[model samples]
Every structure is written in C-alpha cells, then in structure tokens.
Target: MDAGTRNRLRARLVSLRDELLTQGSMNIPPARTDVVSTPDDDEAPLTHMTQAIASNRNRERADRLEQIRDALALVDEDPEQFGLCEVCEEPIKPRRLELMPWVVLCVACQEKHEHEHRSPGSRKHLGDFQ
Candidate 1:
C-alpha cells in the first residue's frame, strides 16, 4: 500500500481501538452483575429472560471489541500485515480496507468463512446482515 493509504488506515485503526475500549469498558460493569433472582410470578420470568438476552448481547459485543482491539495492535506492530487476510494469507483489497479498517480477512475468504460457520437461523439476506 501507499504511504498515504497506510497512514489513513493507521488513523482509522486508532479510532476503532478507542471505540472498542470504550464499549468494552461499558460492557464489563453489567457483565459482573449477579443473575436475576428466580420469581414465582410469570412477569418475573419475562423480565429475567429479557435481562438474559441483554447480557448475552453485551457479552458478544465485548468479545467483538476485544477482537477489534487485537486487530489494532497488529496494525500498530506491522501495518503491512493488515493488508493480508488472517485466514487465507491473501492480500486484502484496498477498497475493503478503506471500508473496514479493522477487517482481517479478504472479501472471498470472509465470505467463505461466514458461509461455512454462520448460525442456522442467522439472517441470510445481504442487506439485512453484515
């Protein structure tokens, strides 16, 4: 990649790292809470279920934030490596990097990976999904 492009990607990586840190910090507090107390009433069950769902979502977000942080660290250590796909060892497209600075996979490898590992009930529509 050109020097200018590398500089732009580095700036974006730094921004993404900061955002991930902020989000991960926010998720940590709620994640430490004790499980909701079991209740005899139906309303309590619904509330508990909602809370559980929220907790799961937070956990997932936190995990993603960690991945983003790691990716940023990799970029800082060796910006050249950021241009390669983590899974297939192929060069990532410049446009892809421009669009998602933290991405670690090329378009073809990413699509293949997602196709093989995506959940059964996951959204299949391109527009509705990432």
Candidate 2:
C-alpha cells in the first residue's frame, strides 16, 4: 500500500484501539447492594446473577481491547504486514482492509481457519458464514 493509505489505516486502527480502551474501562464492576428481603427472593438472585454476567462480559471486553491494542502495535511496527494474511502470507483484499484495518488474514485463509478451528458442534455448513 501507498504511504498515504498506510497512514490512514494506522490512524483508523489507533482511533479504534483508543475507543475500545475507553469503552472497556468504563465497564466497571457491578456495585453490591444490601438485600432488604429474604435470600430466596427472586429479584435479589436475579439481580446478583445479572451483575455476575455483566462482570464476565466486562472481562471479555477488556481482553478484546488488549487484542485491539496489540493489533495496532503490530500495524505501527510494520505497515507491510498490516494487510497480509498471517496464516497464508497472502495480500488481503483492499476492501477487507478498508473494513477491518487490523485484520491479519486474507479472505480465503480466514475462511479456512474458521472452518478448521471452529468449536465442536458449531455449524459450518454455509460457505458464506465468515
């Protein structure tokens, strides 16, 4: 890619990474509250469960933010590697790069990777799932 295009992609990736970080940091731990009713109360249990679920989701978001940061770092370190498939070492399509500047796989290699590594019991029947 040209220098201008690479610069644009880098800027985009950096902005995305910053946004993810900001959003992830905002997902703080759920506050604990005193239960006024019996422990067996439906609302209390449901509220606690919902808070737990939100905590888990926040953790996952933090992990994803880290991944995005790493991807941005890679792009900064080597622009040439930005649009190349990590699995097949092929040039990723420009449109794909435009859509996801930090992607590390070409379309074909991404498809293969998804098919081969998808979780067990996951449906893989469609060709366009990816």
Candidate 3:
C-alpha cells in the first residue's frame, strides 16, 4: 500500500479504537445487587439470559478491540505487510480494508476459516464437499 493509504488506514484504526472504547464504557450494565434467591422467582431465568447476552456482547467488543490494536501495531511494525492477508500472504482488497481495517485475512481465507470452524452439527451443503 501507498503511504497515503497506509496513513489513512492508521487514522481510521485509531478513530475506531477510540469509538469502541467509548462504547464499551458506556454499554456496561450496572452491577445488580437486589436479586435474592427465591424458590418462586419467575424472573430468574430472564435475568440469567440477559446477563449471558450482555457478557457475550462485552466479549465480542473486547475481541474486536484487540484486533484493532493488533492491526495498529502491525502497521507500525511492518508497513509493507499491513495490507497483506495473514493466511495467504496476498494483498487484501483496499475496499475490504476500508470497511474493516482490523481484518487480517482476505475474504476467501476468511470464508475458509469460518467453514472449517463451523459447528459439527451444521448442515453440510454442496460447498462443504469442496
């Protein structure tokens, strides 16, 4: 990638990192201290479900933040390889980077990774045989 594009991407990554941190801080649900265990508590299940969902959201957010940080570090450590895919060592499309600056794989490699990591119970389609 050219200097201008690399600079632009770095700026974008910084902006995105800042935005994610802000969102993470703002989205944290306050700690609940009013819940008491009761044999007939009807809302217990709902409360547990809500906590699980929020925990997942926080985990996802943290993972994305880590990716962005890694991308920024790579940009600084090795500019020549910044836009290259980690799995295939091919240059990722500029459009893809524009949309997701933190991505480390090209679209094809990403698809393969997802396919390989899919749950065992997932339906096998025609493409799975490939």
Candidate 4:
C-alpha cells in the first residue's frame, strides 16, 4: 500500500478503537431472583436469555476491539507488511482492506484457513434433520 493509503487506514483503525472504548462497558442484566419466589412466572427465562445475549454481545465487542488494536500495532511496527496476506505474502485487495482493515489474510487464504479450521461434524447434511 502507498503511504497515503496506509495513513488513511491507520487513522480509521485508531478511530474505531476509540469508538469501541468509549461505547461503555457491558450492561449484563442481573439474574432473576424472583424465579424461586414465583415458579410459575413466564418471564424468568426471558430475563436469563436477555442476560446471556448481552454477555455474548459484549464479548464480541471486546474481541473486535482486540483485533483493531492488533491491526494498529502491526501498522505501527511493520508498515511494509500491513496489507500483505500473512499466509500467502501477497497484497490483499484494496477493496477488501477498505471493508475490513483488521483482516490479516486475503480472501483466498482466509477461506482456506476457515475451511481447514472448522470442527468436525459442525455442519450437518440436510438429510440428517429429516
């Protein structure tokens, strides 16, 4: 990438990191204490589910923040290698980089990596559900 493009991406990463940090901490809902008091309450499960969903969303945000930080570090430490695929050592497409500046691999290598890393039996055949 050219110096101009690298600078632009670096700015974007920094902005994203700041935005995530300023978004405030997770607001996980407290577990329902009334579940025992009213065993017939239909809303108890809903409360718990809301808490779980909030926790997962926060976790995802945290992970994304970490990725942005890593990308920024790479940009700072190795300016020459910022846009190159980690596996193939080829320059990632400019459009791809624009869309996801934190990605470390190009499209082909990323697809291969995901395919290889999938757990066994994670995907079931359509007939399995029949």
Predicted structure with the largest TM-score when compared to the true one: 4
lDDT of 1 by residue, 55-116 (tens): 88778767777766777777678877867898888888887777777688877777777778
Task: Give the candidate order by descending TM-score.
Answer: 4, 3, 2, 1
After superposition, the stretches of candidate 4 with alpha carbons farther than 4 Å from their true spots are 33-40, 119-130
Backbone clash total for model 1 is 0
Q: Over 4 Å off in model 1, which ranges?
A: 23-42, 121-130
What would the TM-score be for candidate 2 when compared with the true structure? Answer: 0.73
| lDDT (tens digit, per residue) of candidate 3 on 2-100 | 999999999999999999888863243434555774533676667667777888888888899999999999999999999999999999989889989
Can you give the TM-score per candidate against the true fold? 0.67, 0.73, 0.82, 0.83
Q: Which ten residues in a row have the lowest lDDT in candidate 4?
A: 121-130
Candidate 1 or 2, higher TM-score?
2
The residue ranges of model 2 lying beyond 4 angstroms of the native Cα positions read 26-32, 35-40, 124-130
Candidate 4 clash pair list: none
